[model samples]
Target: MKIKGLSTIRQKLMVFVVLLCGVLLGLVWLLNVWLLESFYTHKVHTDLQRTADAFSLLIQKYETLEDPSQPNGISPDFYSAVQQPEYTTMLLGKCIEIADANYNCLLGNHALSSGQCLLHPARTTLFGDTGLPSWNNKNVLAYRAQTLADGDMYFTLNGQNGMRQMVVCKNVADRYTVIVSTDLERIGQAGEVIGQQVPLIAAVLLAVSILGAYLFSKWFTKPITELSHAAREVAKGNYQVRVREPENADELGQLARDFNTMAAEVGRTSELQRDLIANVSHDLRTPLTLIKGYAETVRDLTGDDKQKRTDQLDVIVDETDRLSGLVNSVMELSKYSSGTMKMEPVRFDLAQLCDEVADRYRNVCEQNGYHLDVQTDQVCMVKADPDSMSRAIHNLLSNAIHHIGEDGYVALHVKPQADGSTRVEIIDHGAGISKEDLPYIFDKYYRSRADAGKVGTGLGLSITKAILISHGYAFGVDSELGKGSTFWFVAAAAEPEKSAEA
Candidate 1:
């Protein structure tokens, strides 16, 4: 069964704390009511027993200093020792007596006037009867004395001066009997005081507990509450909302960090989605308009003129091919992103591959008054998917041609390293990429400012990055403003096949 008003963590935490404090307060009250008095009585008994034991040891040590004039049956030195602060404190609020085997009052006869002594009856009516059976009773004394003589300690409870008292007796030096008495009335008094103050203590504790619980719950749940608000905002398409991260390295802090990262990604994806729509619309509308315009020209104007009709039809075919290329780029990127495009790796001369890709761009560059230089005469063997490698090289070449510098030059270099690896580079003497754009230049939808209105899709470099990454080849770019850029990758070389010279 669910209770009301506990839907949030704060409410649940407060309730848990309240229940905890209640259980603790109940335990304190129960201990005070049920076990406190007995515990105090037992403590008093233990204290009296320790006093008796201390007196026995002291008496044994001074048994040789007998003095008939001293009521304690010890000399002045023994009496001075007993007068020290420690011994005096131990003897406070307690009556002690010592006796020989003949039942003589060797010590504590002064207690008779105060009526706290069990061995002697009260001499005055001021303190009334002790109501103790062992009070000046010979039979009880004989039995207790005999038990002490047998090397065992003895203790009993009895009424003294209208209050209960605990008595501990022990044999000292096998010659003297030591008896220590302390009243148990203080135990009763303490229990009564605690019982009276219990309600007040419980009230203060409950108030403090509730306040602390509230503050703690608020502090602990603040981040979570903010995160909830941020999440709701994100659901409503407000991806810019972010929550403050906590200082701790705990799960809450990690969740906050992850949430912020996810929010940033979502925001980026949303921006990319918008960019994709705009770019695709612009790209498709031009070619589609061209195809429609040229088709109408062929239908209406170039009817009987075969030469003009074929030319117009050829324009339509080129525009259609451009549209088809855009579609193919999108589909290929999707395949690469989804990990569904399988690679067929083989050993081949990397330098030869570079030359072949450069050859395809040769006439285009020459026709556009741009130079295509292929500096790959070395035979560097490498193992990789040749088709993907060719695509990567072609994309780089195309990107360079589009951004070809005023000098109208682009170069491809394939250099063999001493480690038997091949380093391939595509250099364009065009306006270079900015450092700010370098880190994300290869992202799926990212394009540098320099390539803002370029003719190609932005997915070229991203597809190249995916291809190289899948092959586990190391690739990077170096560029400076107005100095052009160099894009490169290193491919591990495969062993060369045996020559026919042997």
Candidate 2:
């Protein structure tokens, strides 16, 4: 059978938590099982050594009590030595035997037999072939015999009554040797107790960890889930969908904020796309309708009258030209905006270029009863793409001409700044752009309400902006609701020597 793996983050997290808890608990169990016995054994050995030292000190005191002047007899206080807690605890439920140099029991808990020494026959037989000091001597305990013979305290392990025991031996002032013994089985029992409780404790901890992991995974993935749903809605073109922002200051929160920003931008772009289609359709239909209607009128009725024929044909030609200009402007804007237009900048006379661009509209201005004024105090040499710069100035002049009515004047001003830059301004005395519409004037296919009946595509200023921007020139417009507007741009001024020396 195939096993299904954890598919969700919650399942994965819970499993991870359980595994972590298990590993930690297993380590604790291993430590208890492996090292616990040795640690306990070492502790017991230390306690036995300290008890032997204390007993030796007591023996030394008792020996001092027997004055050398009357050395034939000794009076030892065995009662006080055995009463000590360290001595009592070390001897509890264990075999302890103190023997003198002649192997007679000097002081012990039990009474000696008729000829019995400190080492019982059975214990002596156990140590007989062990190569210890007691292998030949049957009186002293094996460990005590070794300490007396070498003057070095030591311990030994041996099996006694089906339990392991540690025997520690120390000599006391050459008068007596003390042997302390304890069963090591109690250390194993303590380990067993710990081993029994580990599973229960681990089970409790694992349960708590699993619950915590579930809640944590749910909380963590909540925002991501909401973002997923929002993205789906956006894919379905419902750009209004927005998720509640997460309160966290982490990467997830930042992702949510960025997602919202993307949605807002996409919504705006969709709205603009719809607006573009409607505007282009309207603009195209108007010119096409006029051209078709005028051509039919000329063919059906105006063909017989010379002035009528001329007027209708002129109207048809004008509409055709307008349509051609609209298509061309659309293509030109697309080229510039898509970065297909190349820029080749050179030093040129800004004032001269403005004069030439203004003069191109002189005939039309005079016919329309408008005056063209050019102002330049000196030659302002600037670095810019000459052809694109000329096109930008032409578009600005065209825009001004369209806005300025009969008897209104359009002025072109070129000024050189002290910072080695040139500023060119095109001013028109016409109904100015509103504050609301001013910001969007340079947006593609955007036209202000003041320009409702204008006879050109709304891409002139946008194309001009793109061209100037590609040249890295600064450009903007300033206008009030009723006061006339001025569109201006700045270009870096060429060095005086470059202009003069050339």
Candidate 1: lDDT over CA atoms?
A: 0.79
| TM-score of each model, in listed order | 0.66, 0.59
Give the Å error, residue 227, model 1: 4.4
Q: Per-residue error at 51 for model 1, in Å?
A: 5.4
Error of 1 at 201 (Å): 4.2
CA RMSD, predictions in order:
7.3, 10.6
Model 1 weakest lDDT span, ten residues long? 122-131
Candidate 1 residue-wise lDDT, 30-112, digit = tens: 78876888787778888878877887788877775458786544687876776677776777677766666755444452232
Model 2 is weakest, by summed lDDT over 10 consecutive residues, at 121-130
User: Pick by TM-score: which candidate is best?
Assistant: 1
lDDT of 2 by residue, 374-486 (tens): 88767888878889999999999989888884458899999989898989999998888999888778887777877665555678898998998888789999998667889
**Model 2 pairs in collision:** none
lDDT of 1 at 46: 82
